[model samples]
Target: MRTAYRVETVRAAESALMARLPEGTLMNRAAAGLAAACAELLRPGLGRRTVARVVLLVGGGDNGGDALFAGARLARRGIGVNALLLAPDRAHPAGLAALRAAGGRGLAVADIAPGALTTLLGRASMVVDGITGIGGRGGLRPVAAELAERVTASGAPVIAVDLPSGVDADTGEVRGPVLPATLTVTFGTLKPGLLVDPARQHAGDVRLVDIGLRPLLPVEPDVAALTPAEVAALLPRPTGESDKYRRGVLGVAAGSARYPGAAVLTVGGALRGGVGAVRYAGPAHAAVIARHPETLVSPGTPAEAGRVQAWVAGPGLGDHPEAERVVNEVLAADVPLLLDADALRGLDPARVRARSAPTLLTPHAGEAAALLGVARERVESSRLTSVRELAERFGATVLLKGSTTLVADPAGPVLVNETGTPWLATAGSGDVLSGLAGGLLAAGLAARDAGAVAAHLHGLAGHAAPMPATASGVTDALPTAWQSLTG
Candidate 1:
């Protein structure tokens, strides 16, 4: 799993490591990693060529020191290195001395003219952004922001020291001008900003520089993304004695005459989710069976559908009286339940809290906004806070779907899944996710695991499908996605 901690946690670990080691040991280790990454980007073993130029945007803090020291290392290697000290007098004294001794030329930001800076930037092979570290907040200062913007437009591959400047280290919020990095070389543990969006958009490919701090860091991270290997461990395989019944049965209550395809798509996801049987309870039986003949279509309500290990309610079931009745029946059941789509509408907080069984709620930003009685923009802007509040208030695991799929319960860290493609924004895709999550619940995964795992699998399936894939394509790719993860 790829995990991320807040800035303070990373700082504490660094302090403890620095106290035991030599004064410059940690800094040298960090500088070495930064230089290596920059080297790989600039000169990747070609024919005889002229020396590449590297520009370091040096600031006033340790972040600037890291870049300056790394610049010294590059200068020693016969590369042309120059540093633009943003805070000339305040820049790390030791770092500046190191760079000067190793033959790196630098100019303070105050002394450089706009035309000179632009001309210098246009010829760079790579840019090392040590302008601000994780400790910097809100956005870059005006002068620094303008320089960042210019360099970003220069087309040079920028390697961020820790994270991209101007992004919130704890929450991935980006404001004002920020340099979107081509790569970020982070020290110690990954920061939350490097993983979550809209800052994730700024932080491109990430490479971690382990300064012997992983063991010293906190056990629980604020955010985590499951790796393929970790996800594979969570999947169930059939033993010799396994049967459809033993594998587990999932009940899907979805669709209406007005939107029968929701039922078809929802069951499509469940069938491919490795369930023993999919007992579908909805008015779209004929439409569902046309696509999937194996489904045992119910002739009555969910309670009459008979035995099911867990239940999935609401995809396109509208806000009719019958829909409420179906929702209440499923909500009141002893088995685990996943609520999605229209099921999230007018949900009673008391009914959700009363359920002793595991419950998962999947909502897009708009639905989450409605549930929380807040603006849609509010939920989108602060998804982490919004999702957590929704889970705590409703007393159920909440999965907030967006560019990053996040699963949060009342406790522990939030799981962020980045496996999705832009094509997943199509219609009925969420129905597939809801069904897959429900199927996992039926297969005995907890609410949080089911939701997070389903999201991961669903995104992988979407990515595996053809570009601009339909919901049906995503469903068809499920078995492939499952095998890919398992393998």
Candidate 2:
């Protein structure tokens, strides 16, 4: 699992490690890693014929120190290194001295003309953003924001130190202007912002730099993403002794005459979700049967549907008058249940909380916002907070679907899914995801694992699908995604 810690946790671990080492040891380790990454980025362009130029955007605190030290290292390598000091008074004193000794130049941003700064940035091979560290919050200050704008205008590929300045290290919230990076070199361990969205989009590609702080860090991460190996371990595989019934049966209650395609897509996803049998119960049985004859289709409600290991409710059962009754019947069933799409409408928290069986909820940001009585914009901006709140409020596992899908249980670390492409945003995709997760639930994965694993596979399918992937295309690609993981 790729894990992330909060800023405070990372800081504590850093302090613990620093106490055991020499004064400058930790900074040197960070600087060395930063310089190495920068050098590697510059290598392809610098074919012995071209001279490499590096510009560091240095701010206050240890962040500035890291850039200055890294600049010194580049200067020693015969690379032209210049530092733009955002805070001349607060720049790391020793680090600045070292840069000067190594023939690196430092110019305060205040003293530089706008046109001259633009020219310098345009000529630079790479820009190192060390403007703010984890401690800095609420976005960049005015002077720094202007500089960031200029740097972006230059179109230089940037390598951020730790994280892009202006993004919240703990919350992943970008309140004001942010300097997006081509790559981010984070020290010690990953931060929540690096893994979560809004802030994640700004962080192009993330590289973790281990500075001997792992051993000192806490065992539990604030957030985590499942690696392929870990996901494979969690996936259910049938043994020789396993029969159709022994493997598991998933009951799906979805679709209406108005939107029967939802049922077809949902059933398609369930069939590839490692389940033995898919028992589909709803109004769209004929449509589902036509598409997937293997499905045990029934026109009756979910309760009348034969014994099932788990149930998936909602997904386009739009105002059929009996839709609520079907949802209630599925909710009342003593089996693991996943709620999605139309089934999530007017959902009662009390009903979900009272359920004896495990409950999982998959809601897009708008649905999530409605459930939490918050604005959709709020949920989108603060994804982590919104998902966690929904999980806690409903007392159920929540899979909030977006650019970075998050699966969170009532408690414990939230799981972030990074496998998906933006193309997964096509319509009826959530229905496919709902059926996929429901099948996992039937296959005996815990609510959290089922939701997370389903998201992982769903994302992979999105990638495996043809470009401009449709919901049906994603469903068709599930087997390929499954094999890619299990293989």
Q: Where's the lowest-lDDT run of ten residues in candidate 2?
A: 44-53
User: Which of the numbered candidates is closest to the native, going by highest TM-score?
Assistant: 2
Q: How would you encode candidate 1's per-residue C-alpha lDDT over 274-350 as one tens digit per residue?
A: 68999998789999988899999975789999899999999999877789889989998999999999898989888
Clashing pairs in 2: none
* Model 1, residue pairs in steric clash: none
Distance from true location, Cα of 161 in model 2, Å: 0.3
lDDT of each: 0.89, 0.93
Model 2 over residues 1-487: C-alpha lDDT tens digits? Answer: 8999999999989888889999999999999999999999889654222678899999988988999999999999988999999889999999999999999999999999988999999888999999999998898899999999999998889999999999998878899999999999999999999999899999989999989998988888999999999989999899999998898999999999999999999999889878999999988999999999999989999988999999999999998789989998998999999999888898999999999999999999999999999999999999999999999999999999998899999889999998988999999999999999999999999999999999999999999999889999999999999899888
